[model samples]
Target: MSALDHIRKLHLPDGARILDVGGGSSVLVDALLRENTSWSITVLDISQSALDHAQTRLGSLAKRVTWVAADITQWIANDPVDLWHDRALLHFLADASDRATYANTLRTALKPGGIALIASFSLNGPEKCSNLPVHRYDAQGMLATLGSGIILKDHWLMHHHTPSDKVQEFQFCLFQRV
Candidate 1:
């Protein structure tokens, strides 16, 4: 199972609201739905086409997911989520100001004591992905960037084999809002 799948299996409060940051076309929502349909799952992405594609792929199950098309740095969340998950999205925030905005937005969107599950390109990984520049990080970097309010719970590195058979290293960090 992927890091995301593993995180989803962890014991969380029943009926926790989950926000999949930059969820886009990822299948993580589908897995979450299968694991616990009772939990409210929302997918926030900047691309409408990505949301549309995910909705198409989900078919009847799509109705259960709340999809939002907006940039995370400035988007106002309609729900106070208990869990926030981001994969590679933080790396895309190349500008320091943008990263700060993202951090502020994260703090504003999630309720304290909530779970934050983030995956990012490791320091040794490619400097660019999907034709865009990326910022590499280790667990310490992520923790520092996220600020002291983040209480580290777990951290690890994983090698992901993409659809094109390329290997990309990623650092996964799990934190609880303190």
Candidate 2:
């Protein structure tokens, strides 16, 4: 299933806080807005231009979302969220220290028992993207990198068809903070 499909299956409670890490200009926010008006959603990305594009596309609905332009490794969560969704972001952290920081950030951003839906390049996927090398992972590798207090709920493999007509393998994992 697609990441959005998995999120929809979650059936999160009304008014739940959601953090879309590196969501940027993704249409996920648009879909989420249509799904539930009561949800408090935040889209965090390092690109201000991308966020602006999303805001323009969203128009009035943009006001409903909190847009944060900061690197996940350095960004601090003022409040914990019920759900954390990341797509094609984790694999970009090639440095071990960066990966550790990402894990810590995830822990700090998610409330106890909250859900995290992380999608990344699979072991068999491209070695690099956008001319930058990526750290690929399978479900087990992801779990190991995330460290303790997070338990895996489910995982699956998917093939993403890029705009350039290239197929990229990805692994999607669902976990719960303890």
Candidate 3:
């Protein structure tokens, strides 16, 4: 199953707080809103324009979401969330310090026993995306980079076909905060 499908199957409780890191204009929000389960969703992205596009697409449903325009490495979550989701964001953190800051932010934002679903470029994936270099990882490497507070529960590789029909390998890891 795709990472998004796996997250959908999680069946988190109603009113569960969720943070979607770097979830710019992704349709994941739309899909979740269509589900019967009620979630307090927050979409955090560095680009306001992307968030605005999503808002325009969602129309009235956008009102249900909390949108934050800030860098994940710099932004501190005011409260912990039950679920933290990141898709294709971590790989962009090629710098060690930035990745460390990301890990710290993640630790601070996720509550104990919370679930974190992170997807990144796999080992065999492209070295660069959008002309920017990326740090590819397998499941183990991802866990190490994310640090000690979380334990890997499951991981799998998926092939994503871009609009241009280019296939990109991605590793999706599911973790639980200790």
Candidate 4:
């Protein structure tokens, strides 16, 4: 997606460790491998089914990725990563406590100056997805919610049409650890 174009512009070091939190079956992993196979990429998800699906989809290239089956709020990485990307997970943290844990985990997982690319439902987007309530935010609201230590590097909004023919607004924010 356009987000990756911006990420690619970062010109991260070769063999940089990247973590895709709550990324389950996203073609980003595939595209990333195609772009640079040297980067160590880890894809984490709470669902075994999703991971399995991704593994199946990736086929032989699946070995190139580290697949972790765990909840982001409860999971901790053994080592820090240079870049973190999340596309499908944050909106589900409707509970304040859950958001705090997620934010804390994010802060802990990154190396200093590391990059985080997060996407979520915008304030003007849907209030819920799959019948679960979502917490929505504009760029400033998201920056406020994340609080300290995260510097807002860039942000933008994009419109997505679902398979069911529904319009959903997505806010993409890029942050760097200070």
Candidate 5:
């Protein structure tokens, strides 16, 4: 199975609250919702235009998913989340402080044993995406940044097939908050 397909199989519970960080145009949440009617999806992004586009694309499914427009660095949730889904977001946080803040937000919002599925540009991936610099990660580097206490459940190196059929290498790290 594909890396993304494997991520979908991560053993998230039914009726779980999932936070999709930087899930602007990502169809991952849509696919997850389709697979499990009981799951609640919340898509968070810094761009309103992107969120609007996602809503339009989701159509009726949009109502079932919550949309939040905010930078991940300043994100905080009143309720804890069961899963934190972050793909192609953490890599953009090249600054040490920004990455720390992003990590803290996730730590604060996630319940104990909550899962985090994060994907970052791999060492072989493009140097830039969307005209922005990105930080590449090997498995250990990504885990170390998130710190200890979180148990690493699994990891995989895979390539994403873009619209133009270009392939982008990435590392997916799964963790359970302890």
Candidate 6:
């Protein structure tokens, strides 16, 4: 299973409000729906088409998810969330300032004791995706960038084999807002 799938397996509180940051067309949203029916998810992404695709794929379950189309770096959330989950999103913000803004947004949106699961390209992974350069991060590096309000829980390395059998390395960091 992927890092996001593994994180979902870790027992979460019932009726938790989850924010899938930069979720787009990722399968995580659909997986979450099939795995748990009570949890409410908010899928936030900059791409309207991506959200549309996800919504179409979800069918009836799509109604349970709130779709927000906005650049996370500049967008401010109106309410706090019980969980913040992002995969392959933070690395897209190659600039320090951009990363800082994303981190700040997470800090502001996560409630006390809320959980955060972030996955980024590892140092060993490909440097770019879709021809765009990505910022690789280790657990300590992610913690340093995200700051002290969120406590690091665990760090896991994920090796994903592409359809062509090429392996991509990813690092997942779990945190809890204090």
Alpha-carbon lDDT, every model: 0.86, 0.93, 0.90, 0.87, 0.86, 0.88
Please give, for residues 118-157, the per-residue lDDT of candidate 2 as tens digits. 9999999999977899999999999999999999999999
lDDT of 6 by residue, 1-178 (tens): 6745665676877788899988987988887887778888899999999999999988988898999999999999778988899988999999999989998999998999988999999989899976899999999999998987989999988898879898989999999899
**Model 1 clash pairs?**
none
In terms of lDDT, the poorest run of 10 residues in model 2 is 1-10
C-alpha lDDT of candidate 2 relative to the true structure: 0.93
lDDT of 3 by residue, 59-131 (tens): 9999999999999988988889989999988999999999999988898899999999999999999999778
Report, for all candidates in order, the number of backbone clashes. Answer: 0, 0, 0, 0, 0, 0
Model 6: how far residue 165 lies from native, Å = 2.1
- TM-score of each candidate structure, all chains considered together: 0.94, 0.97, 0.96, 0.95, 0.92, 0.94
Model 5 misplaced regions, further than 4 Å? 2-4
Alpha-carbon RMSD of each model: 1.3, 0.9, 1.1, 1.2, 1.6, 1.4
Please, what are the lDDT tens digits per residue for candidate 1 over residues 1-178? 5745666566766688999988887989888888876889899999999999999999999999889999988787656788999998999989888888887777777788888899999998889988999999999899888886878899989999999999999999988887
Error of 3 at 158 (Å): 0.3
Model 3, 51: alpha-carbon shift in Å? 0.3
Q: Which segments of model 2 are wrong by more than 4 Å?
A: none
Looking at candidate 6, what is the lDDT of residue 57? Answer: 87
Q: Which pairs of residues clash in candidate 6, taking residues 3 or more apart in a chain or in different chains?
A: none
Clashes of 2: 0
Q: Among all windows of ten consecutive residues in candidate 3, which has the lowest summed lDDT?
A: 1-10
lDDT winner between 3 and 5, please give it. 3
What lDDT does model 5 reach? 0.86
Best-fitting candidate, measured by lDDT?
Answer: 2
Q: Candidates sorted by lDDT, descending order?
A: 2, 3, 6, 4, 1, 5
